[model samples]
Every structure is written in C-alpha cells, then in structure tokens.
Target: MSTLRMAAVSAPFGRDLEEDFARIGALIEQARGDGVGLLVLPEACLGGYLTDLDGAAELPPAFRVGGPEIARLAGLAGDMVVCAGFCETAGAKTYNSAVCVTGDGVLGVHRKVHQPLREDASYAAGDRFTAFDTPVGRIGMQICFDKAFPEAARAQALDGAKIVCSLSAWPTSATNRHPDPAQDRWTRRMDLFDRARALDNQLVWVASNQFGAFGAMRFAASAKVVDPGGEIVAWTEQREGLAVAEFDVDAVVDAARGGMDFLRDRRPDTYPATGGTPYVAA
Candidate 1:
C-alpha cells in the first residue's frame, strides 16, 4: 500500500541551529508518535526572519546555505523526508531557499521563485522547479508566495508530482478573516491558486505554514491539506498545534487519472509553464 503520512509545522521563527533543532526534535517526536513519514515546516526556519536584515552582514556566520543547520535537522528524523526553509548564499547573493532532506541525505533543494515585496529586495528569484521521487509518491515543494503563482505548483504537476507540499511563512493577510460574503469571495480568489492546483491537477496540495507572529510579521496559521479534488482534508485556523494526516498514494494516483487531469489538458501548444498572472497584482 502506497501511503504517506505528513506533518505540517507552524511556529514562530527560532534563533539558531540549537533552537531550530529543538523544534525539529519536538516535530520528530510528534511525527514518530503519529507514524508520519514526511514533515514540512515554515520558511527561513534556520535563520531567524526579519525584513531589517537583508544585507546586515550574515549575523551568526553559521547561517549560510547548506550549513550545519541542514545536517542537524536531517539527522533528527530517522526515516522521513523533511522540507525546511533557510537562507541560501550563492556567490555574494542570498536567496530564500528550502532544503529537502530524507533519511539517507539531502534530496536537492529549491529556491523561492516569487518573493514578497521586501523578499524581492533581499532574495534573488529562483530559476528552477524541483520534483523528486519519494516513497509515498512523486512530491514537490514551493514556498509561500510561490503557491499564489499557478505555474509554480503546475510545474510540479507537469513534472509528475502526485503530491505537492508548500512550506510557507505566509504573513497574515487582511482578506483571510472570518468568512463573510466579501471575505469568502476574497478567500477563494486568493486561495484559488492552491485549490486550482489540487483540483485541476488531481494531486494533493499540502500547505504547511508558520502561523502566528514573529515579532511584527504574522502568519495566519491556516495550514491545511487540500485533496486532489481541492477539498481541504485537515488543517488549523490558528497556528498553535500540529496538523497530521495520513494519505493514500493509491487514491492520489487514481484521482489524477480521472475527471480533472490538469496535466493531460495542458495547452503547451499556446501557453508556456503553469505560472500565470501575479496574484497580488490587480
């Protein structure tokens, strides 16, 4: 039976490797008890996040790309693939990148494509798309704002990803409040990208986010698992606890084979990649 149980972590940004490792330890313990095979956490997890530190001399010096932080989290989980966000230093530039790790070792990494306002000022856009084979099924990762872009997730689907996991540090958006008619409309349009990717592609879209506030930056903590049909399976509105769910790889495979085959109906004839219009742009 092809199955992948996953955990989405949501907490404030931790300071150094020790702090991150401690959280990873707690995450591992929870995952172990839940029998989860995969764990996805928030963005910039290793290095603490603050819009003020764009070029302020890599604070800890220990916070470089593929630094000891990577090994620490990788070693923490015995047999699970963990996706975490951290700063990636290439040449003299720093990128908002996510590290993909498994039981054996790191399975490549992806830099964030579409960064926020301050993010673009700080991070260089990532050029590639990452899709890899996992014991559960083919999986992919795109962080925060990347989920708002269609192509980011669609590209993964095209790459044969049955499950696409998004690790985010989504700041609290005014539109995502108590569901009123107007709020409802706004929410759908906003989350439409996430839903479209899942429903249209017939793939599971796991949106794990860092909820609550890290000083001034706040995450909605609205992390949830959207099924292939675009229906949310399990999630949380507040960023306090952990959300865990067991998914059947067979179901995902079967779903992608049915009605909404986003991959099959691709208009590669006219359109380019899955990335469409900018969500924030009017």
Candidate 2:
C-alpha cells in the first residue's frame, strides 16, 4: 500500500488495566472503521501514569515485555500496526517503554531514554535510542521527556526512521497555569517541539498525548499527525478524540527532501563536542 492511513489518539487512561484495554480496543476498532492502518496511543496507556511524584516507595504497575498483557495487545492489533506505551519490567528493573505491534507479534520496543521530574524514582532510564522496521514503515518511538531532546529523534532519523511516534503525558507547567491549553506554555512547547522535530528530521511525525487530569497534573491533549513539511494535517486540540491522516509515506518524504535533504546535507564534522563546548559561528 503506497498510502497509509494513521490515527493519533488523545484520551485519558488510569490504573484500571481491564478498562484501559476496553478503551484501547474501542479506539482500535474506531480507527479500523475509519480505514486507519496505523494507530498511535498515548504514554502509559496500559498501566496509566504516575499520580504521586514525591510519594513513598510503592511502585506503579509494571509488566514483563513478554507477558500476557502484550500478547493480548498483539491479538488486538490484528492487521493494523499499533503503537502504545506501558510500564515495562525487564528482570528486576522497570522502564517506561513503548511497543509497536501487529497480528504477527511485537515488531519493536522503545525504552524511554529521558526521564523528567520524579520519573527516575519510578523507572530506570533507557541507555539507547534505536529505530526498527514496521509493517507500514521504518519507525521510532519516544516517550514524554524524550522528545524534548533533539538527539533522541535525530538518532532515529540517522537510523532511517521514516515515521516517529512520540507518545507523551505532557502537562502544563505546575508554576504557570493558563485556562486554555492552546495558550499554555507547556502545550506550546510540546506543539513547537513536535513540528520542529519533524521538520528538523524531515520525517512523518505522529504525536499522541494523554488527556484529562491525573492528580494535580492536567494533561494538554493536542494529539496530531504532522507531515514532513512540519504541517499538522489533523489534530485534536484539548479534546478526547482521534486525529487521523493519510500519507503516501515515500512520496511525502521524497517531496519534502527533494529541495533540501537535511540528513544527507548534514555537516557532522563541523559540530562541536557535547558538555561545555565553546560556541563557534558557522
């Protein structure tokens, strides 16, 4: 298929796993009915997200990567490619992870590399960023804070990821509050980062974010599907719904890069080293 129909969802998910699955199943079916071949769900959709950041040692729910929950998700995936997040248990350490799955099985898994706030207290940080092949295309994933770092998405771009699914539970700044999510600084940053990352890498960007309130945090639900040109084709601004868009992946990428191939034209040799490098004018 040259053109792939995709859906990015903005919805609230909590501690109830059964309820979560029901909601996910309904979303998947809804996307399927809309002729979507790929579906991207928000961060911590399976086991929900952290409610108390500064609390005690009690852990949030974590499941093994090869556990029954993933198997159930794989079964639900059916013919459509589904990307969703969960708290992953690998041995004794648990990481905030996202998985790409279809009827065949789990295609790829991304353990979120960047942890913000008290997230580190809950889950171990991932050490690497990698992209893998999926049914629709070569894809990469980044969780919440991961997208804030340009290197995270750039690494995937370097690995030849045509599409990047960024799952986030992003909320407004605790210090600065805006009545409208569209005017909120955090939401603005999220939207800007989404467009900039896509345009910077020249790749299709599928952004999904958690909606509604979780404790003191009120999530900014601006789920969207952005083209390589940094244009949002479809979006759900502070609402619980699906943002769907159709793309001929190759054609879109080709058109975007035809004029200026950022990856190919990159001058890595001129780049300074990380950690207190003197700024040099290019």
Top of the candidates by lDDT = 2
Evaluated against the true structure, the overall lDDT of model 2 is 0.89
The positional error of residue 8 in candidate 2, measured at the CA in angstroms, is 0.5
In candidate 1, stretches whose alpha carbon ends up further than 4 angstroms from where it belongs are 52-65, 174-191, 272-282
- How well is each residue in 201-277 modelled by candidate 2, as lDDT tens digits? 88999999999998777999999999999999999988999999999998898788888788777766576452222
- In model 1, residue pairs whose N, Cα or C atoms come closer than 3 Å (at least 3 residues apart or on different chains), thus clashing, are 151-274, 151-275
Model 2 off-target regions past 4 Å? Answer: 55-58, 272-282
Question: Model 1, residue 72: what's the lDDT?
Answer: 74
What are the C-alpha RMSDs, in order, of all predicted structures? 5.5, 3.8
lDDT at 141, model 1: 88
Q: lDDT of each model, Cα atoms only?
A: 0.69, 0.89
